[model samples]
Target: MRKRLQTKLSATLPPEQLKKIYNSFDIVGDIAIIKTATPNLENAETAANQIMVIHKNVKTVFAQSSPIKGDFRVRQLNLLAGENKTITLYKENGCQFRVDVEKCYFSPRLSHERARIADLVESGEVVVNMFAGVGCFSVIIAKKVSQTKVYSIDVNPTAFEYMQQNVKVNRVYGNVVPLLGDAKEVIQTKLQGIADRVLMPLPEKALEYLPYAIMALKPEGGWIHFYDFQHATREENPVEKTKTQVAQKLACIGTDYRFASSRVVRSTGPNWWQTVLDIQVSGKPSKF
Candidate 1:
């Protein structure tokens, strides 16, 4: 069915727009599928342009291709239903990370949260990004915050390749080190008692890695941006859940810490919120 629709779109769209549209699909696969009765060439062009800009530094763009009736495509492209571009960031005040939308994979919301986390990091800080996808958080931090060295860990080879490219594109290749492996193992070996700030953006599995993150933090103090999704009903409290998890981890390690802050960074789905916890770790205080 998809192949048939692709054929029809090829026939219906103008050669130029068809090329662009086809290229968009080629990069993103069926992920960016559009459904429309009458294809809007102007809107398609705009979407293509946005993709090009987001993937400016990438060698290729990979997208899912689907046929859309003209009206829906027009509405989506014009931001009537909101933009469809992935969250590969391009510009920042301190550093820049040009996303290769085709090869790299990630949500736009995650990219924005990474940028915000980058802003909070300081120079010379030892930073570790667990589940670092295509080095989004690591590249942004290294590029923007001088003196900070980042250990970016990911299991995906494709994302690692783009991660390396992003480090160079952002001109922070020297500061950002890409580690291609499961963060659970890689972080344990490379970052024991060294990280000043840790980013755990893998919401679904971040809780499982809390022990490693706690062990990796500097003794005197450190911060963690632990990402997790939970229900956001009036009776639900994401922050409290995060605190409970942190307390459990602290108990397991027999270490003491205090919660600095927790804030909702983005919404993952209906009634689901993604939150970050800022924790400060310390040793037992001596009696006066």
Candidate 2:
């Protein structure tokens, strides 16, 4: 429903904790997911009830039980209110996504990020999403840009299953190709030099798979949408720091590239930010 559903809360939380907990309110499809690092809610159950009362369209509410961890990147959810189901249909950028919030990773916060990448895709381009969770980016890109072919890859079998269904749900079978395996291996064996553009959306694996991302691009070169996380104080620029680090690593590998776009996507923590770099890779990277 709503990414940030605002409402009046005074009794459950003090004035200090209200903003943090309120801002943490997130909804994917009809499921509302609440996540907060602070452990100071006076009446957590009451607050959960309040959400259901205020939002009639919310079919489910879950307290994010664990941090998004592991290779699968799935969130552990504890039912707080509403239906005891983790599956929902999330709509974004004129595209629909069928996702299991507990079994598969999905972020409503990245709705704009997804749209931004799709906008950069030119028609007839062949795209490869290195971390296409549930085929969101690939489906959206294929939907928005006509005549584009997207090879969607994911290692998680569960996510891949959902991805296959989502591609069908969206009716982009010809446009989006779902491949299940480790992206790096998949690229080396089958997808080398096949893409006009490549997307590395998973921040954790983006840097580790940088070389494979380069390999996926055409020899003449193409664009890469890279994501990473960086911590910066109020005085430091996280995006700049991330850019420098990536630049250094890419240089070590002799990957010729330049930034086409870069920005702080979101604040992951107090001083930490998730940054993205739209890099135009030239020629090719050194072979490992």
Candidate 3:
């Protein structure tokens, strides 16, 4: 998609600025969002306009002017062209989600990851998603696997509202339970020891809430889909470092665990990567 957009943008932007356009852009429904540094803003505007022209489906174009930040993980957007609206319906894995881009956090990049985790779920397993932004992961799992029950919790009220709406939109209300408030508190009061699987997709707070995720799992222990951000040079392995830390933490919590798998989900920055570890935990420890 970037290649196609760039090919069309080349006609409007200078040769030197061609490569300046970031390779990554997001198309959430009818909106096209591009990230352009200050130096490349001019070219990005042209590209945004060109994008709408090339892709008739794109009715709006916005440049991501700031990094994803804040408790809600919303980014600052600069309108480049077309419609002023930010609300759209994003479809993924045969489920539909209505989202306000400026109010909630939804990433098309994680679509594959969501589906991957859903596929790993057994039919009767229960899942607790600590940072269930719009319940994308929860809804997908419920929609894909009929017997699974997912308790999706989010701190952001706007996200929670959208999550509830999405539950109805996708007809997964019976499968996914959307809750508003802090995940840690929710887990402590209502969700402890009920999950066969726990999802910690919020890397920013995943480590701090690690204990809660562990507590949510059954006494027999189960699976945890853990996400975290790690920085490493070319010589170091981020996944290994993360696994070691998590293993140490697990041992401290008296949970026997093994890293079933690990992979880089995306490059967050230079030498910084977002990684996921699929951990299998047992009630007692044994030497792996």
lDDT of 3 by residue, 87-175 (tens): 99999999999999988998998988999999999898999999999999999999989788999999989999999999999998779
Model 1 lDDT per residue over 1-288, tens place: 334434555645667666545543323321343323344655564544444444444332222333222311112222212254543555544555555443455444455676778889987999888778777778778877889989888777777877888788878866888988877788677777788988887777778887777667776658877877778687878778777876776676676677787888876546878888877767522220
| lDDT of model 1, residue 176 | 87
Give the alpha carbon lDDT tens digit for every residue of 7-76 in model 2. Answer: 4566556766666667787878888887876434344455566777778778887778688999999877
Alpha-carbon lDDT of model 3: 0.87
Question: At residue 212, what lDDT does model 2 achieve?
Answer: 93
TM-score of each: 0.66, 0.95, 0.94
Residue 31, candidate 3: alpha-carbon lDDT: 92
Candidates, ranked, lDDT: 3, 2, 1
Candidate 3 worst ten-residue window by lDDT: 279-288
lDDT values for all models: 0.64, 0.86, 0.87
Q: How high a TM-score does candidate 2 get?
A: 0.95
Candidate 1: C-alpha RMSD after superposition: 10.5
Superposed model 1: Cα runs more than 4 Å off: 1-104, 284-288
Q: List the residue pairs that clash in candidate 2.
A: none
Better of 1 and 2 by TM-score: 2
